[model samples]
Target: MNDSPGWASPGSAPSDEPDRGTEEQPTPAADADGPAAEQPSPPNWSKEQPPAGQWSSPGIPGQSGPAGGATRARAGSIPHQGGWYGQPAGGPPMWGAGWSPAPQAAKPGVIPLRPLGVGEILDGAASTMRAHWRTVLGISLIVAAVSQTLVTVVSGLWFQGTGRKAAPDGSSTPALRQAMRDMADTLAGSAVTSLIGLLATLVATGLLTMVTSRAVLGRSVTVAQAWQDARGQLLRLLGLLILYPLMIFAIAAAGLAPGIILMATGTPEAGLLLMVFGGLAATVVSVWLAVRYSLASPALMLEKQGVIASMRRSAKLVRGSWWRVLGIQLLSFVLVALVESIIQIPATLIAFVLDGQSLMDWANGTADSAGWTFLIAMGIGAVISSALTFPISAGVTALLYMDQRIRREALDLELARAAGLPGYGTDTTSAAAPGAPTDTSGDPTPGS
Candidate 1:
């Protein structure tokens, strides 16, 4: 084999001749200066070649000598045939035989440029928040404070007089009416507050997606920069967020509608049985679809895709990784829930203690208003929980999308170039490497 660098294949070798060892040796003529010719060689020529198989290939272990025990070639020397330093043509190089250790992947930012494990994904998210706390936490805090304040105000004013009102005579009819009234009021208040929060969450997700992308490149971004980068796609992102939940709701409602109709027509027992079966099937379907499209948000933000296009991109990426995606997403949800509970529980207890009278009135179904102190304290807790949890949730999602891309599309090369890593950014050949995505238009493609 050719022992020269850049000659990876036998066909590229400089010659096809057999080694000189196979040729017959000629008798040497007497030296013109016989005594001087027998003298010891000069210092430059005195060093003897090391024994065969003395060196191993870099990065590879255990292998000794070149392929087939052929003589080793010096560095920068070219062999007439065979492979590098006697490595067999078409075979890998031996350790220390014209080989160097592979470069460690470039890690300019939160994650190394490679396919990531679950722990690494989680760690990358946390690292992004830690490394760029001011920008990340600032975005979270603003969104959380605004959303939580709206929710608190709506709960306080809209449901102040919504407690159950039993009649003086203790009639079942009045008690039933009051229960229905309270249920309706609670649902209405919850719906309004949830909508407010959802809007806030949409904005936070878009901005944080941008922040996490930059973080992965080992770059920090300010809040304004994140906003600028993400602003163009915010509407499409909002459309995606709205469409995904509506799709889930539609599936659930379709599953339950048949049962509701049957019950209304007076077949209560059969309707109830059907409802249970239908609900389970619907839940399975919903979960499958949710995992399939969980990556749409990041695709929309980074790829500048339309809502439908982004969803299609996500589905393509997640086609064969449904369970893995679901597991990671579920883990993130559990973590966020735990964080929220830890922060809010103490605040809730404090609020309850400070407004015991209002709590008692509500318990007795005689509350006329939500106490200001209680509402304020609970809102503070909500804000704090949201502030901390938002970054984690958004960071996990963005990083997960990146991980999927790196695994399936060889995205790390592009990321490395974007990060300006040496060799990666300057290599013109990597663009044509096998399995590397070549499309630069940002259009949604099944394999890209």
Candidate 2:
């Protein structure tokens, strides 16, 4: 388990028994060696060479020497090629060779309390869902049902029928007129749905971020508890949600407005060129800003920051890793889109088949469609799809925020401690604690 402690267990302590002698005495050799060559000067103890049965270097042997009974191997020596590591051929073994280093602890939570890999981030999100399915799925199901119900109601109210006017030439043109009306209504409905969806998303993000914080510590959170922790930050998060898109819209509009005016005044060629070029430029800026402020909501909810402050915090966190963050976010979005399409496409096809109208005729608003049946069926499918999608999207966003903090702030250590792992102090605070002061002694702020 990744969360398992790296330290050895207590039972691994070495014994303190003293060493014993096991030397074999040299025989007299029947006085044939002529007094053993004058007893050869006693070997020096201070020389570089080790005594017999001792190691010189990793693989080299030292000169032999006489000793009590038998020679003592040098202390704390590495084992020879095939030797057992039981009692070294010398004194008592030093402490701590009794056990191998303890296997690293399991991560014990949605993620290992360390810098996360891309797969780990995705896995963490899935892990959170699996661990707290009731809370996570409940939040998503409620939000999805409400959002999809609103869409169904809105579509029923505004999308069923249309009024048409005669052409300027006094010819009937119901198809063209109906198409125009459909387009207008669809755009209007999309705008309203987007607003409602954004509101739901803000609330969901707040609740899930709280859940994720607890999940990081391997603790499950209830929906009510999540709401309690999250409610205070929702307003600021919602403000951020509103303000961020407005900033993008404002940039795009500012870029395109001049070109629009020129085209309206009849400089079609120049206006077209400017519109295309300006749009491209605005797109580049918008994507950069999107990635830059991506962490703002999590920063606000987790750090208890104000709207503008959260934006600043996000900017601080994102400073050096823009491309990486952007890639990961884009990948997450693609996966979300894929999941939605997989589930919703079949539902939509089922709705279409059950509606019993020719595709062309229905699209042209010429068929007597089963309006409520179509709307309700589609709504149900949408609800199911959204329910499955919401948790993943929320989890990914929250984990990405944490991953960034881990990289920038060494947050994994704090998380490990918070998770009650060994080697980490039990009283240490969370690295993402709201408004926590950084240790400015030598620490580099994100900007630095």
Candidate 3:
């Protein structure tokens, strides 16, 4: 084990076993293949330990140790056979033979997850959305417009033909009725539009991440620049698009089949039971998928990893954080739906008016069922909802990935280092020797 803390002062090395609270700077070394690599400068943190047996949390200031380390065992800066400042026992060793004590985490409510409320989720999402309002709304609108236009125009033509039929008198139906049904078909075909919207969203989502991260660091990038940063991962992004939907469909379909079978059984009680079971199954599946892919975009976008690599990395990062990821996702979806509802209301009302149905008439289904009018009305509503909802949905997912990193890795510091922020790790003046392996970088990770 390279006994030195990853960024500790050179002389601050553990005494025989380094003493806590001392730090020094290490000098760089020659590059292995070419020139020597330089050392990293002045240590960032001074290790602090309480009485050795009294599990000291080595985490940075302000963060608490997990539940007083009450759940399982000891909490300390002890280097376990499993790495990280943890108290891992007889399982596989993390990073390698060391325990990095975990810090207390922040949740979404009760200041963080204790007293959860739906409004907290809605308001948080709203705040996040507002922060990136330009990108969020712009991308969603673009998605809505492009997808809606294609589906509407194409279906209008397709249904126009499908609506045509010979009467018993061997005559075609009236052009107006055919036209109206064609429009309705186009409106119903919004699913196709939704798929294309997903692709547009892949782009929007990735770029939002780059831009938002920059914003977090008090920097900004033009949308075009953000797009460039996101461009390299397009293939991986598309791969995720394919894989994710298939997984969602397969699980949901599998869950739904059981419910359908139960419902088909004679007893309503059986049907209700099956529904409850099926819903639970689907919920589990969604949570599993969300956690699995929580880090995929970051892995792909920032690490320049491929689709499978990204997926594998994301899965690893979320190994112990499943429910938390699921909750965040659930909260995100619910918030998006609420936002869509607000947008849907006004559009629906306007459409109803345009279609010759008064709000009350339509609400009560008392208006004349003018086929063409109905098609146009519904079509308008779909178009509007798609435009407004698409971007924010995509943006929220990207934001979730960022939040995950922040919570798990203290990634803001890593990002700062990457950006060459003052006092950050990567600057040459403050650089660490690349080749002088303390062999400790992966210590926090277990047996990796």
Candidate 4:
């Protein structure tokens, strides 16, 4: 049996050891006629020589002496063999045995959470769009547009412009426009306000949830895909969307229970006290619940969970992470507000200026505001603002939702598995619905 070190370490393990050591070791069969067999006296001790028992490199044997036990084969110790690793003649494999591994870069489409600077969020959104443009662009645009649309309609209904309300066209205002616009600030507008709020909430929740699911998967999908994925579960999502704020309202309203006891049988002061406590409790409850269940939309979109399931999932994912989400949300709100103020204020100021009213007259609410042109322009400005602001806001919420799951469940790893990326965990396709806007569970190929 031949037990050469080159055959041992870089090559192949030495063939099973000879049964007994004392017998003269048999030379390898193919090499019997080779030069080593023909050598009469000279033996090169330094190279191509290995100790008998299971050799591993311990130290390079000094030129003067035998290595203590094991030998450290020097650079030239083994002859280079090409066909072993099937390299072309005269060159090594691109990645050779001597190469050390490199540190891997972050997976594409990931949003890192280190303190991001101005435009970081936009950059993240743009990167996501660039990477999964086919997957993300249409859906993002659709969602963005729809979200903006809903917000625009709702805002138009809820907040009155300074002048007569015109039809969407810049045409003349309707006969009852002033009355309707005036009623916007009255109790009668409550119904219109609630309905608009509900619709807006539903659209935003479904879209943002989809964004979250795709983000976690490190995948991008389009509006059609998102809409399709969400179409079936939308009612449920809407219910959930309405439920959250409603629950908060209910809790806050509960504070009125004590005051109601006094008022129901007796005095106005009891009712007043109930209103005060109820209002305060509602404020605190609403804020906390909004933050707590922020993740619920994605949970539903990805997990097909019920309202409770989604809420619980969100609550669990956000248990200790509320403040971070809150801060991110607040930041987004400020951006939205800043951008909106910048755009709308000028339009408003222009309207006030052109209305032929003095500054004092306008401030005193006695200004005869500009006609339908001003209102139409204001509507256009509002729509444009909503279009730009809402999409990014939706994107951030979705991104944040995905990030939470990634941190808690190693969802990114699971997503990698789904995307056929190396080093991922179990594939999660089954967790998503059939016909859902996900393409992660397929094999990946190069050079199609």
Candidate 5:
């Protein structure tokens, strides 16, 4: 086989020709009609056969050799005896006489410059946080704090202004009105909080993606540096963020539309059944689409691509590994959820304790507003949870993107050169490679 690292492609097995330096060499034969053709012909296979077991298999003991009947053993050579079927007597068998271990991949940063396993991807994310906490946590903290504070204020005002009271006479109509008001208030509060969180997530994801990219090359980046590097694409990222959810919503709406029409035409039972099935189908499709496009944020930030192009890039990378990608993304989500629950649950209890009367009033539908103590406590919990979990979620996504590229496109080679490893053929004076973490400016350019 030609000398190259890693496994050779199929059908390129080792050559079977004997070494040229061997003592016995076949001489070139003369023309068929020459005088040499008068020599006796070799016997046919059926006419003359050796006795059973006369010749041992190659590389086995008792095999005849050029030196006579003596057996010879070569150091580091594969033995082909037949005792344990194929295993050696003492332990596992070696590969072969010429076998050598492959070179260890270069690891200049959080991960080795090669395709990654699930554990390695997660570990790389955590390592980025540990290796560059200053930048990573700083970005998350600022975003979470600002967003949580706004959410707390909005929630307090919303609860105060929209509080509903039960009917004094125990009338069903007043109770229904109260329920409708509660629903409207809940929807308004959720929308405000969701929008705030989305903005916070956009900023944190963009900044942390840059940090994680540099960390992969064993480089450190400051908060300002990451922001500057990511600023150009933040608008495009915003567009992507908005577009993705809208797409899912549209899918769900389309699924429910027919059911709504059926109900309006007086087929309530059939309409409800159709809605159930359609909603389930729509949920499955939405989840599939979510996993398919999960890596778009990192692609947008790192590759400087427009929204649609980045999404297309994500789709291409995830095409063959959809289930694997889904598993990893789900694992990250579970981990983030666990962390949030751990932090927020205690904070919620503390908030209840701090304003037990308000909690009781809210339960009885008598409270007009959330107390400052409760709002502040809950906000602190949210801030802490978001601050810690943002880095993890963003880092995993960025690393997963890199890992896919490494597996499919040999991006590790570019990463190695970008890191300026000794033997990766990096040219010190040349411009940065395509996958290198360079500062990009201006808006993202559109592409397919």
Candidate 6:
């Protein structure tokens, strides 16, 4: 029931007659504790008007007026009363004698029902983990374990090489061919491992995005609920994941194509210069595209849109605020990187300790091979590290998408309704803050 500052109740002003110090000031006996002690009368705000140009508000006791003249009303302040406590004859005051600021929308989950700042977005992400640790961490653990195992197996099979020996044919050609074959095998194994990791990541992203959406509504969801919500559109999310990287690759190749042609035609020096500049240009464009469409996966999962539509949605949202979005995303990345390093460094050290010097020897080429123990320890470490990092990365992306929508589309009002906050949606007087736009056509919510 507290009124905002710069508003006053119907009364609480000095009396019409000049105030005599004797009545307004408390008698000395009023402070004494005895049968004869006099009690001071409380000021009757209902019958008084504050001093001219001063301010006070009902429900808020002891409000003081501005130092000089009347305070100017700020944007959201309620209008003041001019006379006695009786209600105005024409109608109710814009703010009744007893004015109160509107109640804030509740935040029972990750985010509040309002536009979010960067800190709030980060906090909401962390809160999702704290509130639903079992589901979030469990998903991450399984993905990490499976992906790490596959990576270890692939590395062992394809890249664990024996020492190179002199060519049997006594020519460098045989050695060169063998080295090239080994390189190709290594690249193939890497690609396979990467593909597996990408699939696991897509699944995790979809599931976590569902959880985050529910979390915004102060709702609890099980891993099963998350899976149910995400599975229908899982394929589309995966397609998005694949398509983005391919687009970047195509752009990069196009940029480098001219240089390659020039080099093939024996213009090596010019080709080198063109290659350097072109690669730089490609790198810049790639980053711009990446940041622009960074919200695509979340949009795809939440909006139930196709890969192309989600990408378009993200581009639209990011159109004018590209720099701000990029900065926030970059900050999230830096934070995630820091957390991953903190967790992985200790895990890697433990792996080294558990496996003695064999892992280091193999890494340094001082030994022909490493033992299974080294590989297993490293695999476990990788799993643990990935599990810890996965939720944070997923959470940041989801919340960032929500934040953008809140600013651009007034999605906060919709989220308030979805969260079942009272006095919102249809309650115009109290639905939104003063001056906030009123648009309540709901987005195609995630998990709907």
Per-candidate Cα RMSD to the true structure, in Å, reads 11.4, 12.0, 16.9, 15.0, 9.3, 13.7
Superior candidate under TM-score, 3 versus 5: 5
Worst 10 residues of 6 by lDDT: 438-447
TM-score of 5: 0.78
Evaluated against the true structure, the overall lDDT of model 6 is: 0.73
**lDDT tens digits, residues 1-448, model 4?**
2111112232333468533335775764556555454435676678766543222323334333254543432232222311233223343332232332333434534454222333555566556545655545454445445544554455455554544323445547664774575666654545664566567657755764565456544665666656766677788888887787678767865877777777887887868887787778777778888989887776776666788988898888778777877888788888779988988888777765654446676566565534554555565566556555555666666666666665565554444555444444344443333544443334221000
Clashes of 1: 11
Question: In candidate 5, what are the lDDT values of residues 265-298, reduced to their tens digit?
Answer: 9999999999998899899999999999998999
- Candidate 2 shows a clash count of 13
lDDT of 5: 0.78
- Shift of residue 98 alpha carbon in model 1, Å: 10
Per candidate, the number of residue pairs that clash is 11, 13, 49, 5, 0, 5
lDDT of 6 by residue, 1-448 (tens): 3111224454344557673334666456543555656566887677666444333455455555457433432223433322333333344334444445544546857887656788988889889989998998888888788888888887776656544333457676777778787668767877998998899899889888888887887777788878877888999988899998899999999889999899989999999899888899999999999999999988888777798988999998788778988988898889878877787777667766775765556566565444466677778877876777777788888988887787666667666755555545544334434343221233225322
Residue-level lDDT of model 3, residues 73-163, one tens digit each, is: 3443344221344434443233322344454323321112112234543344455446656765665566556665665565555454342
Q: Rank by lDDT, descending?
A: 5, 1, 6, 2, 4, 3
Per-residue lDDT for 3 in model 4?
18
What TM-score would candidate 3 get against the native?
A: 0.55
User: How do all models score by TM-score?
Assistant: 0.75, 0.72, 0.55, 0.58, 0.78, 0.73
* Candidate 4, residue 423: lDDT: 42
Candidates sorted on TM-score, descending: 5, 1, 6, 2, 4, 3
Q: Quick one: RMSD of model 3?
A: 16.9
Displacement of the residue 204 alpha carbon in candidate 6, Å: 0.5
What RMSD value applies to candidate 2?
12.0
Instruction: Give the local distance difference test score of model 2.
Output: 0.73
